[model samples]
Target: MAKRFFIKTFGCQMNVNDSEKMAGLLRDMGYEKAQTPEEADIVIVNTCSVRAKPDNKAYSFIGNLKRLKKRRPDLVVAVAGCVPQKEKEQILRFPHVDLVFGTFNFVKLPQLLERVKREGRVVEILNRKIPEEEKLPLVDSYLENPFIAYVTVQRGCNRFCTYCIVPFTRGRERSVAPHLVVEEVKRLAERGVKEVHLLGQNVDFYGYQGTDLADLLYMVSEVEGVERVRFTTSHPAGFSERIARAIRDIPKVCPYVHLPPQSGSNRVLERMNRGYTREEYIEKVQMLREFVPNVALSGDFIVGFPGETEEDFEQTLSLVEECVFDQAFVFEYSPRPFTKAATFKDDVPKEVKNRRLQTLQELVKKQALERNLERVGKVEEVLIEGFSPKGSELYGRTADNKPVAVEGSEELIGKTVEVEITQASPFFLKGKPVTTGVRSKR
Candidate 1:
C-alpha cells in the first residue's frame, strides 16, 4: 500500500506552483495524494508571511493540524513556505509537528520525511541559501486550468525592500536558464496548454548575460501551441524599453501587466528600498501605454508603513487616482522578522493602518467597477477554462485577464470562444458566447 500525503498551499501563485512541485516529488517517493487531512499519513502546509493576518492564520492552521496528529499518532506533519523560514525556532516549539521545511529547502523533503519515519522524531531543513543547482521535480501539475500553467523562470530578489521578507527568505536573485524556460514552455504548449504565466520574484529582472526577458519572451512566443503569454510582479526599475517593445511585438503575449509600485510617495518608496522614484514609475507606465494602448494594468500598494504621515498616505491616494489601475492588491504593512523594517519601531498604529487600508480598498473598488463598466457590450475573446463552481456557467478570462462567466459546454474547455459582454461587476463579468470560434479584432 502506498503512503497518502496531503499538501495545503497558502500564498501567492509562486507558492501554489511550489505545491505542485512537492506533489510530484512525493509521488516519485511512493506517496499518493490525499484529498483531505484526515485520510493522509503525511500532511504539508505551504505558508506565507506577507501580512500579519496570513501569518497568524498559518500558525492557527498548524495548531489545528497538531490536534489532528494527536488523534492519529502515526501521522507525519510538516510546515513549509515563508512562515517556516521566518519563524523556524518558534515553529519547532510546537508539539505535533514532525517536519519543518522552508521555501528554499524543498528538494530535501524526501530524505527529511524518511528521517522522521525512521527516528520517530522531529526533523527540520530550512536554510536561507540558493543552491548552485536547484532541481525541481516534474510531477503531474495539479492546475485548475489545463490550458493555463505557471512556469517560474527565476527565483529570489536582490532588492531588500524594507517591508518585504522575500529578499531574506528566498535569498538573492537566481535566474533559470533561458533555454530551459523556453523548453518548458514548449513542452507545456505541446501538452495543449494555450497560456503560460512566466513567474518570478521580479520578472523584468529575468536574464543577466546571454538572453534577457525580452529575448526570452520572443522565443516563448514562437512555441507552436502556446496562444497567450503573461507574467507577474514586475519591478518598476526593471521595466526597460527593450522589454516593452518585445511585449508590443509578441502577438501571443496577453495585454496585461502586474507592476507593484508599493507606494506613490518618493519618500515612502525610498524608505521601502524600491529604488524607483514616482516620476520614473509614471514614465514607465506611460511607456507601456504608448506601446500597448489597450493593455490592462494592475499593481500592489501598501496603505501604511512605518512613519507614514497623512501627507504620505495622501500621496499614495493621489497616485492611485492618477494611475487609474484596473485592479490593485492593497496591503497594510507587516514587519517580517528579519527584514529591516522589523528592526524599526512599528510606530504606525493598527487603527491608522486599518483606516488607510479601508480608504484604499474603497478607491480600488470604485476604480475596478469603472473599468469593468467600460467593457460592457464589447466582444472579448476568452479561453474556456471550465464550469464555474457557483453555477452551470463556464468560466474564462479575457485577454486582459478579467474573469468572465458564460454559459458553455464541456467541449468548449481549452478552446477559445467569443463572449459578448452582457453584464459587468467590480471583480468579474457575465457574458454569453456569441460563437464557437475566437478571432483577433485587430
Candidate 2:
C-alpha cells in the first residue's frame, strides 16, 4: 500500500488553504490521502490560535494522539501553523509530537518529514517568509473545489489590535508579488476555477513593490477565464477609497466585503487599539455603499471586551442597527496568551457578556432578515456550487453573497443561473430558477 498522510485543519480559510499546500507536497512525495489519522503513516494537525477555544482544541487533539503514537511508533506526528508558530518548541514537550513547524516552514515539509524519520524529531519555524518560487509550486494540486479556490494574497498582519494574536503567530505583513498572485490565479483558471477569494489577515494592508490591493484586484480580474473575484478580512483603518472604487468599477469582482470593526464604541475601539473611531469606520462603510449600492456588508462584533460597559455594549448595538449589516459575527471576548488585552482585567461579568452577546445576536438576526427580505422580489445571478447536504436541491450564492436554495439538479453545479427570490430567512434565501435574462443588480 502507498504511504498515506492525514491533515486535520482548524479555524479560518487561510489555514484550510495552507493545509492544501501541505497535502500537495505529500502527494508529490507519493503519499496518498488517508481517511483517518489511524490509517496514515503521517498525521499533521494544522492548528489555529485566533481564539482560545480553537487553540485549546488543537492541544486536545494532539494529546489524544498519544496512544496512537505509541501503537504506530512509526507514524510521524507533526503540528503545523499558528499554534505551533506561537508555542514553538514548547509544543514538542508533548513527547508524541515528532515534528513542529510554523506557518512559513510548510514549504520545507518534504525534507522535514525525512529528517524527522531519520533523526528523532524536528522543530522548524521561519521568522522570514520563503520566496514564492519556493512555495507556490507545491501549492498546485489538492484544491478542495476545482471550480472555486482560495489564493492567499498576503500573510501575517501589521495591525497589532490588542485583542488579536495574528501579528505574533503569523508574523508581520508579507505580501506575495502581484504578478505571482496573478500567475496562480491564471493557473487555477486554466484548470477550470471560476471564482477565487484572495485570502489574508488584512487584505487592505497588502503592499508590495509600490502596488496595493486595489491594483492587485484589477490585475486578477483581468485574468483569462476567471469569472468571480473576492477578497476578505479587511481592516477599516486603511480601507482606501480606491478599493471602494475598484469594487465599483470591476465587473468580475464579487459584491461583498467582510470588514471587522470589532466594536462600536470609540472608547472600546481605543482600548482595542483598532486605530479608527466608530465614526471613521462608518464613513468607510458609507463610501463602500456609495460606490456599490447593492454590495453586501458583513462584519465582526466583540460584545464583552475588557472594561466594556453597558453603554459601550449599547453603542455596538446602535452600530449594528445603523450599518444594517447583511450578516454579523458576534464574539464574546476571550483573551489569548500574547495579546496586550490579556494583561487588562477581564472585568466584564460572565452573565453580562452572555446577555450582551444574545442581545447583539438578536439585533443582527433582525437586520439580516430585513435585508434578505428586501431581496425577495429581486432576481439574483447565482453561481451554482453544488447540491444541498441532502442532495435534494442545488445550493449557491448570489453575486451579493446571499445563500440561495433552488430546486434544481446535479447538472447545474457549475452553471451560473438566474434565480428569482421567493422567500427569505435570517440565515439564507429560498428561491427558484428563473429563465429571464435579467442581470443581477449587485
Candidate 3:
C-alpha cells in the first residue's frame, strides 16, 4: 500500500508554495495525501518564524505529535521551513521529530526521507545557497488552489534590516533564471492558472543574468494563458520607476504595489537600517501613483520598536494618513532571533505596544474602507479563484489586487469577469457581476 502523508503549513505565501512543492515530492515518491494527521504515515510541519506567536503554535503542535508518535512508532514526523532553518538541530529536541531540514534543502526531500527512515534521525540545515549541482524538483501536482498560483521569482533578502530575520533564515537574495520562471509560469498557465503572483522576500531586488524584475514581468505576461500577473513584498529602495512603467504598460500586470515602510520616523528608520527615509518612501509611493493612477497601494508598518517614542508613533500615524493605503498590515514590534534589533533593549512596554498596535490598526482599517469605498460604482475585472471558506459565495481578486466576492456558481472559476463594486468593508468588498468578460484596458 502507498504510504499516506499530510503537511501542516504555517506562514506566508512562500511557505504555502513550499508545502506544495513538498507535497509534489511526496507524490513522486508514491505517497498519497492523508485526510488528517491521525492516519498519516508521515506528518511534515512546515513552520514560520517571522513572529513569536507562530513559534509557540508550532511547538504546541509538535507537543501534540508526541502522543501520535507513541501510537505509531513507524510514522515519520518532520519539521521544515524557517523554524527548522533557524533552530537547526535544536528542533530535534522534540523526540518525536524524526527528520529536520531547512528551506535550502527541500529539493532533496526523497533522499532526506530515505536517510531518516534508514538511519533513525536526521537534521540538515544549509545556511548558505543551494549548491549549483543540486537541481530543483519538477513537482507541480500539489497546488492548493487550481486557478491561482504563486511563482517564487527570487529567494532571500540581501538587505538585513535590523528587525528582519529573512536574511539569516532564507539566506541572500538569488533571482531564479528568468527562463525558468517563465517556464514555470507557462506550465501553470497550461494548468489553467489565470493569476500568477510572483513571490520574493523582496521582489524589487530581483536581478538575474543582467535582467531585472521588469524584464521578468514582461516575460511572464507574454505567456499565452496568464490573464493577471502580480508580485509582492517589495522594499522601497529597489523599486525603480522603470518597473512602475512596466506595470502601467503591461496588459497582464496587475496594478498593486507592496512597498513596506516599516517606520515613519526617520530616527527610528535609521536605527532599523531600512535604507530609506519617510520622505524618500513617500516619494516612491507618489511616483507609483503617477505611473499607475488606479494602483492599489498596500504597505506594512511596525509599531513599538525598541526605542520608539510617542512622537515616533505619531509620525507613523501621519504617514498612514498621507498614504491612505488600500491595505495596511500593522505589526507590533517583537524582536526576532538573529535580527540585529534583538540585541537592542526591548524598552517598549507590552501595554504600550498593544495600544500602539491597536491605534495603528484602527487607522489602517478606516483608511482601507475609505479607499475601497471609492471603488464603489466602478467596474473591475476579476479572475474568479474559487469558493470562499463559507462555500456560499464565489471569491476572486481584481487586477488591482482587491478581494472581491459576488454571487456566482463554480462555472465562473478561472474566468475573468466584470464586477461592479456595490459595498465595501474594512476587509473585503462586495460586488455584483456586471459583465462576463475581460474589459479592454485603455
Candidate 4:
C-alpha cells in the first residue's frame, strides 16, 4: 500500500500555501493523502507562533500525537512552519517528533524525512538566504481548491515592528522577479484560476531592480484570463501614491486594501516601532479614499500593549470612529520571545485588556454592518467561490472582498456573475443572481 500522509495547517494564508506545496510534493513521491491524522502513516503539523493561542494550540496538539506514535511506531511524525523555525531545539525535545524543519527549509523535506528514518531524529534549519534563482515553482494542488490562488510575490519582511516575529522566523525581505511573478499568474490563469491574491508581509513595498509594486500590478492585471487581483497584509508606512493610483486605474485590481495600523496613539505607535504616526496613517487613508472613492478599507489593531494607558485606548477608539473601517481584526497584545517589546513589563491587566477588546469589537461590528447596509439595492460583481459552510447556500465575494451569499447552481462555482443585494449582515450579504448564463468580464 502507498504511504498515506495527513497535514493540519494553522494560521495565515502563507501557511495554507505552504501546506499545499507540501501535499503536492508528497503526492509526487507516490504518497496518498489521508483524511485524518489517525489513519495516516505520516502526520505533519504546520504551526504558527504569531499569538499565544496558536502557540498553545500547537503544543497541545503535538502532545496528543505521542499516543498515536506509540500505537503505530512506524508513523513518521513531523513539525514544520514558524513555531518550529523559532523553537527548533525545543520542538525536538518532544518524544514523538521524528522530523523538524523550518519555514525556509521546506525544499529539504524529502531529504530530512529519509535522514530521520535512518538516524531516528533529524532537524534541518538552513540559514542560507533565498536566492532569486532558487524560487520554487508555483505548486498547483487541484485537490485543494484551484479557482482562487495565492501567488507569493515576495518573501520575508524588512520592517521589524517591535511586537512582530515575522522577521526572525522568515528572515529578510526578498522579491521574486516581476517577470517570474507574471509568469506564475499566467500559468494559474490557464489552469482556470479566476482570482489571484499576491501574498507578502508588506505587499505594497514589493520592488526589485527598479520595478515597483505599481509596475507589477499593471503587468498582472493585463494577464489574459485573470478576472480579479488582490493583495494583503500591507503596512501603512510602505504604501505609496503610485500603488494607490494603480488600484484606481487597473480594472482587474480589486479596490480593497488591508493596511495594519497596530495602534492609534502616536506614543503607542512609536513604542511599537511602526515607523508612522497616527496622523500619517490617517493621511494615507485619506489619499486612498481620494483615489478610489468606493474603496472598502480594512485594518488590524492591537490593544493593551505595554505602557498603554486609558487615554491611548481612547485614541484607538477615536481612530476607529473616524476611519469607519468596513472590517477590523482586533487583538489583545501578547509578547513573543526575541521581540524588543517582550523585554518590557506586560503592565496591562487581564481584565482591562478584555474590556478594551470588547469595546473595540463592538464598534467594529457596528461600522461593518453600517458599511454593508449601504450595498443594499446595488448590483455587485461577485466571483462564485463555492458553497457556504452548511452547504445550504452558495457564496461568493464582491470586488471589495465582501462575502455575498446568493442563489445559484453548482455549475456557477468558477464563474463571475452579478448579484443584486437584497439584505445585509455584519459579516456578509444576501443576494440573488441578476441574470442567468451571462458571465462577467475578466
Candidate 5:
C-alpha cells in the first residue's frame, strides 16, 4: 500500500513552489496526498521566518502534530523551510519531529524519510549550499485552477541586508540555466497554463553571475503559448536602466513590478544595508516610469527600524508621497536572529512602530484605491483563473496583475477574455465579460 502524506506550506510564493516540488517527489515515490494532516502517514510543515506571525504559526502547527504522532506512533513528521533552517536544534528538541529538513536539503526528503522510518529516530538535514537543480523534484502544481503557475528561476540572495535572515538561510545567489527556465515555461504553457511568474529572492539579480534577468525575460517571452511573463521581489539596487527599457519593450511580460524599498529614509536604508540611497531609488523609479508609462508599481516598506527617529519616520512618509506607489506592503520592523539589526538596541518603541505602521497603511491604501478608481470603465484582457473563493462568480487577473471578479462559466477558465470594468475597489475589480450572450449573436 502506498503511504499517504500531507504538506502545509507557509510564507512566500517561493515556499509554495517548494512545497509543490516536495509533493511531486512524494507522489513519484508512491505517496498519495492526504487532504488533511490527521490522515497522513507523513506530515510536512514547510515554514517561513520572514515575519513573526508565520514563525509562531509553524511552531503551533508542530505542537498540534504531537497529538497525531501519539495517535499513530508510526507517523513521520518533518519540518522544512526557513524555520527549520534557522531553528534546527530547537525543533529537534521536540520528540515528535522525526525529520528536520532545511531550505537547501529539501530535495533529500525521500532518502531522509527512509532513514527515519528504519531507525525509529530523528534526522536533521539542512545544508547551506545551493543544491543542484537536478536533485530538486519537479512537482506538478495541483492547484485548483491550472491557468496560472509560479516558476522559480533563481534562488538565494547575495546581498545580506541587516534585517534579513534569507542570506544566511538560503545562501548566495544562483540561477537556473536560461535554457532550462524557457523549457520549463514552454512545458507549462503546453499544459494549458496561461501565465508563469518567475520567482527569486532578488529576481532582478538573476543571471548576475552569468545570465541577466533581461536576457531571461526576452527568451521566456519567446516561449510558445506563454501569453504573460512576470517576476517578483526585485531589489531596487539591482534594477538597471537597461532592464527598465527591456520591461517597456517586452510584449509578453506583464507591466507590473513588485520591487521592495524596505525603508524610505536613507539613514534607515543605510542601517538596513539596502545598498541603495533614497535619491538613487527615486531615480530608478523615475527611469522605470519613463520607459513603462502605465506600469503598476508595488513595494515593501518597513515603518520603524532600530534607532529610527521621528525625523526618519517623517522622511518615510515624505518618500511615500513622492513615490505614490500603486500599492505598498507596509510592515513594522521586527528583529530576527543572526541579522545585523538584531544585534542593535532595537530602540524604537513597539507602540510607536504600531502607530507609524497604521498611518503608513492608511495613506498607501488611500493611494491604491485612487489608482484603482482610475481604471474604471477601462476594458482589460484578463486570463480567467477560475471561480472566486465566494463561488458565485469567476475571477481573473489583468495583464497588470489586478484581480477582477466577473460572472462567467467554468469554460472561461484558462482563456484570456476582455472584461469591461464596472466597479473598482482598492483590492479587486468587478467586471463582466465583454463578449457574452448579446455580443455572441453578432
Candidate 6:
C-alpha cells in the first residue's frame, strides 16, 4: 500500500501555502494525503513561533500524537516550519519527533525523509544558501475551486522589528525574480485562477535589481485571466506614492491595504524599531486615501509594549479615532524568544494589558460597524468564493475585502456578481444578487 501523510498547519497564509507545497512534494513521492493524523503512516506538524499560544498549541498537539506513535512505532513523525527553524536542535528533545526541518529546508524534504528511514532519526535545520538553480516545480493540488491562489513574491524579513522573530526564523530578505513571479501568475491564470494574493514577510519592500512592487503589480495585473491582485503585511516605511499610484491605476488591484502600524505613540513606535513615526504613518494613510478615496484601510496595533504607559495607550485610541479604520487587529504584547523586546521587562501588568486590549477592541468594533453601515443600500461587485458552512447562502468578498453573504447557487461560486447590500453587520455584509451574467475581467 502507498504510504499516507497528514500535516497540521499553524499560523498565517504563508504557512498554508507552505503546507500545500509540502503536500505537492509528498504526492510526487507516491504518498497520499491522509484525512486524519491517526490514520496516516507519517504525520507532520508545521509550527509557528510568532506567539506563545501557537508554540504551546504545537507542543500540546504533539503530546497527544505521542500515543499514536506508540501504537504505530513505524509512523514517521516530523516537525517543520518556523518553530523548528528557531528551536533547531532543541526540537530533537521530543523523542518521538523522528525528523525536523526548517523554512528553507522544504526542497530537501524527500531526501530528509529517506535519510530518516535509513538512519532512524534526523535533523536538517542548516541555514544553507538556496542555490540559484533550485526552483519550485509547478504543482496543482487545488482540486477544488482554483479561482484564488497565493503567489509568494518574497521570503524572509530584514526589518528586524524589536518585537518580531520573523528575521531569525525566516532569514534575510530575498525576492523571487519578477519574471518568475509573472510566470507563476500566468500559469495560475491559465488554470482558471482569477485572484492572486502576493505573499511575503514584508511585501511592500518587494524589489530586485531595480524592479519594485509597483512593477510587479503592473505585470501581474496585465495577465489575461487574473482579475484581482492583492498583497499583504505591508510595512508603513516602505509604502510610497508609487505603490499607492499603482493601486489607483491598476484596474485589477484591490483597494484594500493591511498596513500594520504597531503603535500610535511615536515613543512606543521608536522603541519597537518600526522605523516610521506616527505622523509618517498618517502621511502614508493620507496619501492612500487621496489616491483611492474609497479605499478600505485595515491595520494592526500592539497594546501594552514593555514601556507602554496609560498615556501611550490613549495615543493608540486617539489614533484609532483619527484614522477611523475599516478594520483593525488589536493584540496584547507577548514577548517571543530572542526578540529584542523580550530582553526588556514586561512592565505592563496582565490586568492592565487585558483592560487596554478590551477598550481598543470595543473602539475598533464601533468603527468597523460604522464603516459597514455606510455600505448599506450600495451595490458591490463580489467575487463569489463558495457557499457558507451551512450551505444556506453563498459568500464572497468585495473589492475592499469585506465579506458579503448572498443568496445564490453553487454554480455562481467562481464568478463575480453584483450584490446589493441589504443589511450590514460588524463583521460581514448581507446582500442579494443584482445580476447573474456579469463576471469580473482583467
Query: What are the lDDT scores of the predictions, listed in order?
Result: 0.83, 0.87, 0.86, 0.86, 0.83, 0.87
Query: Clashes in candidate 5: how many?
Result: 1
What value of lDDT does candidate 1 attain over all alpha carbons? 0.83
Question: Taking the tens digit of each residue's C-alpha lDDT, what string does model 1 give over 145-238?
Answer: 6688888888889988888888767877878887778877777777778889998898889885778888888988889888888987799999
Deviation from native of the Cα of residue 205 in model 1, angstroms: 0.8
lDDT of 5 by residue, 341-435 (tens): 89998788899999999998888888889998998998788888878999999988888889999978978877788889999988789898886
Candidate 4 per-residue lDDT over residues 1-442, each given as its tens digit:
9998999888888887778777777887778889998989989999999888888898899999999999999999999989988988779779889998888878767778789879988888776665442244444453356778888787788888899998999888888899988888888888888889888878878888999888999999999989999998788999989989999999999999999888899999999999999899999999999999888889989999999999999999998898778888888999998899999899999999999999999999999998899889998888888898889888889999999998989987877888999999998999998975456752
TM-score between candidate 3 and the true structure: 0.96
> Once model 3 is optimally superposed onto the true structure by TM-score, how far is the C-alpha of residue 50 displaced, in angstroms?
1.5
Error of 6 at 344 (Å): 0.4
Q: Which segments of model 6 are wrong by more than 4 Å?
A: 131-134, 138-140, 143-145
Tell me how far the alpha carbon of residue 61 in candidate 5 is from the true structure, in angstroms, after superposition.
0.9
Candidate 1's TM-score: 0.95
Per-candidate TM-score against the hidden true structure: 0.95, 0.95, 0.96, 0.96, 0.95, 0.96
Task: Report the C-alpha displacement of residue 374, candidate 6, in angstroms.
Answer: 1.3
User: How much is the lDDT of residue 359 in candidate 5?
Assistant: 93
Q: Show the lowest summed lDDT stretch of 10 residues, model 5.
A: 433-442
Name the regions of candidate 4 deviating beyond 4 angstroms: 131-143
Off by over 4 Å in 2: 133-135, 138-141, 435-442
**What's the CA error at residue 323 for candidate 6, in Å?**
1.2
- What does the lDDT come to for candidate 3? 0.86
